[model samples]
Target: MKINPLLVGLFLISPVFILLISYPGFSVVDSSEVFQVFKFTFHQALVSSLLATVFGALAGLSLSSIFDSKKYSFVESLYYAPSFVPVLFVVFSCLNIGNLWQISFKGFWGIVVIHVLINVGLVGALYSKILIHRLSLMNRLSLVQGLGVWRYLRKIVFAHTKKDLLFLFAVVFIFCFTSFSIPLIIGGVNSTTIELLIYEKLVVLGEVEQALSLALLQLLFLVFFLGLINFTQAKEKAITTSWNPFFKNKIFLLVPIFSFIVLFVGLWLSASFSLGWFTELALLPTLIKSLGLALFCGYSIFLFFQFIFSILPHSTFEFFMSVYSSPSTVLIGLALVVVSSVWWQGRWLVLLFGYVLLYVPVLFKMFVQNFLSSLKPALKVSRAMSANYWLRFKMITFPLSYSLCLFLGFLTAIWVLGDYALASLLLEADSTIALVAKNLLRSYRLDQASFVITIIIFCEFIIYLLYKGLAYVGGQKY
Candidate 1:
C-alpha cells in the first residue's frame, strides 16, 4: 500500500500536536520576568553567534590553505570534534579548567565563551569546505592577479560567503538561545535563558500553563527565524589546487586545537581514582542502562531514517520535513510527561520517541539531506524503469547510504549517552550515567563527575567501533 508523505510528516510532528491539544487554560505569569529572560537570551545568543562566526571564518580561511593536502585531512575532524560530543562533556571540561585556573565560568561571558568554543570548530570546518568547494576557482584567479590577501578576502571571499556566514550565525544563535543544559549548568541566576525559565516553570514551580506559554513563544521565535533563512545546501564540486602560502596562517587553527586540548586536559586534571564510588553508588546498573539506551536510540534513529528513505522523492514530504522544526526540548518532555501519566509503563517508550523526533531532523540536515539529494538522479531513473519502491531502496539507496546511516546512528547514540536534559525530565531517578554525572557536578564532586564523563566517552568509542565494524561488514555484503 502506498503511504502518503503527509501522514509520515504528521507522525513526525504528532508530539507538538499533543502539546497544543493538551494546553490548559492560560495562567498568569510574570510578564516582566519573562521579558528579562527574553532580553538576556537574545543578547547572549547574538553575541555568541557573532563571535563564533568570526572565529570560525578565521579558522576556515586558515584551513582552506591545506584543503588540497591529503596529509592534513584529519585536521578537519579537529574543527568538528568539539561540537560532536555531548554538551555535558564540554561543560564538565570547561568547569574543570576553570577550577584549575581559578577562574569563574559562570554567567553571560562564561556562557559565550563555551558557546564560541563549541561552535567555532563547526563553523571553521564548514567555512573551509565552502571555500574549497565554492570559491576555489575564484581564490586561484585572485592569487594569480597579484591581489593582496587582505583585499581579496574583503572583496571576493566575504562577498561570496556572507550569506553562508549569516546562515551559520542563525544556526548558532538558535542553539544558544534555546540551549537548556549549558545554560542550566553554567548560567548564573542573572543569566537564565528562556529554555531554563521554561524548565523552572514546569519542574520547580509546577506552572504547566506558564511553561507551555513560554515554550510556544520560543517556538514562534524559531519559526520566524527559520522562515527568514533559506537553508540551501551547496552542491559538492571537486577542486584541485596547490598550497597557497597566503592562506597558511596557523594561528587560526589554534582556536579549535586549543578548545580540543582544554577538554582533554581538564578532564585529565579533574579525574581521580574513583573506583569505590562506582560500585557504592550502584553505577553499574546505570552504566548498563545508559549503554543499552544509547544502542537502542542509535538503532531507532537509523531505522527512522530508513523509513523516511523508503518513501523517497516525494517533494511535498521532503519539503515538510525540511522546514519542520522539532518542538523545544522542554516542550517535548512536557508533552511526553502528559502522555506518560495516562498510560502504564509508557514513560520509556515516549522518552525514546521524543529523542528520535528531536535528533532525526538534526542528522537529516547534517548528512542525510545531502546524501538523499545526490541520489535523485538514480532514484528517478529507477522509477522510470518500473522498479518497485522496495527494489529501488534495496538496490540503489540502501547500499549507498547505510554506512552514513550507521555513522549518524553512532552520533545519535553518543548524544543520547551524554544526554541529561530529557532524562532529568522523564525519569524519576538518575537512570543514566549522564544524569549521574550531572548530579555529581551539581554536588561539587568534580573528580567523580570527570570519571563518569570518562566512562561515557569510553562508551562512545566502543559504540563507534561497533558501528565501524557493522559498516565494514555491510560493505562487504553489499
Candidate 2:
C-alpha cells in the first residue's frame, strides 16, 4: 500500500496541534513577565542576526576569492564545521575561551556571541556559494565597465544580494528567537529568552497551561514571519571564472581564521584530557546507550527522507514542509511526557518520535527539498517515459542522493548524541553522555564537562568513519 507523505507529515506534527486544541481554557500568566521575555528574545535575535550577517558576508566574500578553484573545496568545509556540531559543543568552546581570556559569558552579549559563532559559518558558506553563482558574470561585467570597487559593491553587488541577505537575516533571527539550549545554559536570569521562559514555567514551576500558551505564542510569531518571507535560491547558472578582484582583499580572511582558532584552541585549553574520571563515573553504559540512541535516530531520519523522496515533486507538500518549524522543544517534551505516561514502556519510542518530528522539518528545509528540487527535471522526464516510481528512484534518485543521505544521517546522529534538552525532560535519569555532561556543567564541574565533550568529539570521529566505511561498501555494490 502506498502511504501519503503529507499524511505522514501531519501525523508527525500532530503533537503540537494536540496540545493547541486540548488546551483547557486560558490560564493567566504574568503579562509583565511574558513581555519582558519576549523583548529579550527579540533584542538578542536582532543583534545576533545582524552581527552574524556582516561577519558571514565578509567571510563569504573572502572564501569566494580564495577558494575559487575546485581543488580548495575541502578547505571550505572548515568554515561549516562549527555549525554542524551540536550547540553544546559551541557553548562549551565559547565558555572555555571566555575563561581563558577571563571574560564572563553569562548574559545577553554571551548568548549573542555564541549564536553568531554558530551561524556565521553557515551564513558564510551560503553567501559564498551564492556569490560564486550569481556574481561571477556580474564581476566580469563590472570590470569591463571600469566600475570602482565600492561603487560596484553598492550599485550592483548589494542590490543583487539584498533580498538574499534579508532572507538570511530572517532565518538567523528565527533560529536565535527560538533558541533553547544556549539560553538555558549561559543566559543569566536577566537575559532569559521566551524559550527558556517556557521551560521554566513547564518544568520548574509546573505551569503547564502557561507553558502551552507561550509555546502557541511563539509558534504564531514564527508562522507570521515565515508567511512574510519566501526564500528562493538563485537558479542562475554558475559562471566559470577567475577570482573577483573586489573580494581579493586578504583582510577578510581573518573572519574564518579567527572563528577556527577560538573553537579549537578553547577546546584544547579546557579539556582535562584524562580518562580516569570517565572510567570512575561508570559512564560506559550511558555512552553506549547514547551512541545507540543516536544511531537509531539517524537511521530513522534517513528512512523517513527515503519515504519522502519516493513520493517526489509534490509542490504543496514541499512548500509547506519548507516553511514548517517545529514547536518549542519544551512543548514537544511535554506532549511526549504525557504520551509516555500512558504507554509506560514506550519512552524510547516517544523520544524517537519527538526527534523525528523536530528534525524532519529541519532536514527537509536544509537538504531533502533541495535534493528533490534538483531531481525535478529528471523526474518529469522519467514520468513522460512511463517509468515506474521504484525504477526512477533506483536508477536516478538513489544514486544521486546516496552520499548526501549518508552525510545527513551522520550529522543527525552527532546532533542526537549531543542533545540533552529534550532528553532531560523525557528521560527518568541521565541516560546519555550529553545529559551527564550537562549535569556536570550545571554543578560547576567545567573540567569534567570539557572532558566529556572531548569524548563526544572522539565518538563523533569514530561514527563519521563508520559512515564513510558504509558509504564505501554501499558504493561498491552499486
Q: Please give, for residues 1-478, the per-residue lDDT of candidate 1 as tens digits.
A: 3777788778767777887788756666798998999999999999999999999999988887874565456787778878877798998888888988998899999999999999898889777866776677888888778888789889888888787777777677877888888888889879989999989999999888888888878877886776566454344443544443446677888888788888888788877767898897688999998999889999998887777777777887766665566677988888888888897497877888889978876566545655665677788999899998889889988877788888788888999999999988889667899999899888988778888888888888898789879988998988
lDDT for predicted candidate 2 compared with the true structure: 0.80
| RMSD in order of candidates | 2.6, 2.6
Q: If candidate 2 were superposed on the true structure by all CA atoms, what would the RMSD be?
A: 2.6
**What TM-score should be assigned to candidate 1?**
0.92
User: Per-residue lDDT for 42-150 in model 2, tens only?
Assistant: 9999999999888988887777777446533644676777777777888888888898889888899999988988888778777777677668888778878889879
Give all TM-scores, in the order shown. 0.92, 0.92
Q: Which parts of model 1 are misplaced by more than 4 Å? A: 67-73, 143-146, 231-246, 474-478
Worst 10 residues of 1 by lDDT: 233-242
Residue 35 alpha-carbon offset, candidate 1, angstroms: 1.7
What residue pairs are clashing in model 1?
none
Q: For model 1, state the Cα shift of residue 451 in Å.
A: 1.3
